[model samples]
Target: MTATQLSARALLLDMDGTLVNSDAVVERCWRRWAAAQGLDGDHVMSVVHGRQGHLSMAILLPERPVEQNLAENRAMLAAETADTEGIVPVPGAPRFMAELAGLPHALVTSADTGLARVRMAAAGLPYPELAVTAEQVGASKPDPEGFLKAAAALGVDPADCLVFEDSQAGIQAGLAAGMRVVGVGPRAAAHRPTVQVADLTSVRVTRDADGGLLVAL
Candidate 1:
């Protein structure tokens, strides 16, 4: 199906595993945290992806106070942001971003502004003209707040936006916002998004004969 065939008006994209391949970087950071706490790092990172930072810290360091976990996780994330050697743009992500520029597109992510900037800069991707970070919304993915915030920022109604996400939490957020969702990445199918593609490499947006943009996957 094409995007023009549908009524979608805007595009909302996730940052981490979706637009940029930061899985290894994230896993490494979380592993350090786990080691410090004497828990399995891989296990912690597995539960952390697509979830809020504070939430992930809470899951991994349940014994620690929420504030403490938040502080530690934030610090670790800051360090990770500074060390973005392996983090790069996902395949087709840069081209996709370039194609979507000057259109109604927004980055809606659970990452805070600082870390988002670091990752995006490392990926050598164009910065979104509009963005909604974790700090901008009271609630994160699965709550619909982030996606809703992006729609609001774009001056588009929830139903008019099409979201591309890779995480269950992010897909749920888009779905909850009453928008169509396109899932990307290995774990995308778990979210049951409206359309699922293996990666950005499988999708493209083009203008149809009708002069409307068609998102093909």
Candidate 2:
């Protein structure tokens, strides 16, 4: 659908891969973790996309108990924080965010609160007025918990919001929450979002004559 087709009251956005270029850092951290566990980094990265660290740990090292996975994930997060040199905002993300500033919007991410802060700060991204971090939601992407929580926090019905995402799992979560989805990035095209664009550069949010927010792509 075109941006004119969407009449959104709020916007829900994802962090990694969407507003931020954390993919390399994520893959490197996960690969490091996988190596320590004698697993393949490629395999781990694929399974962990848009998933919480705990979930990724569990999947990568299923033989270990949940507690251990949690600990390892924390350690990995620390490593990632120390290596934040490469982290930066996605193309056009800063401008897109500026466009949405002061508007109703929330960031929903699979990263735990601490990790989320570290990443967002590193990328010089503004913190959303509202957010659903890994600690706040029971389920991660591919599940609607985060997106739904964002909608609730924004005081908007799911149907009245639009979700911006990059991963297949994230797009699925937005759709599951009954919100329109705008996908960004290369893999975004595979998810069949309401709209697909290479980056936030292709997207624009404007006030419609009807006094509603219109999202265009």
TM-score of each: 0.91, 0.93
Which regions of candidate 1 deviate over 4 angstroms? 1-7, 207-212
Predict model 2's lDDT versus the native: 0.84
- The positional error of residue 158 in candidate 2, measured at the CA in angstroms, is 0.3
Clashing pairs in 2: 3-215, 3-216
- Model 2: residues with Cα > 4 Å off, grouped in runs: 1-5
Give the per-residue lDDT digits (tens) of candidate 2, residues 1-217.
4344567999898999899898878877787778888898788877887888778778767788999878877887778767786898988888888889878889999887777788888888888878899889888888998988888887889999999898888999999999999888986898899888788876788778866688877
The per-prediction tally of clashing pairs is 0, 2
C-alpha lDDT of residue 120 in model 2:
85
**lDDT digits (tens) for residues 37-117 of candidate 1:** 888766776687787778877766677798897788679768777888789888999889988977788999998888899
RMSD of each: 2.3, 1.9
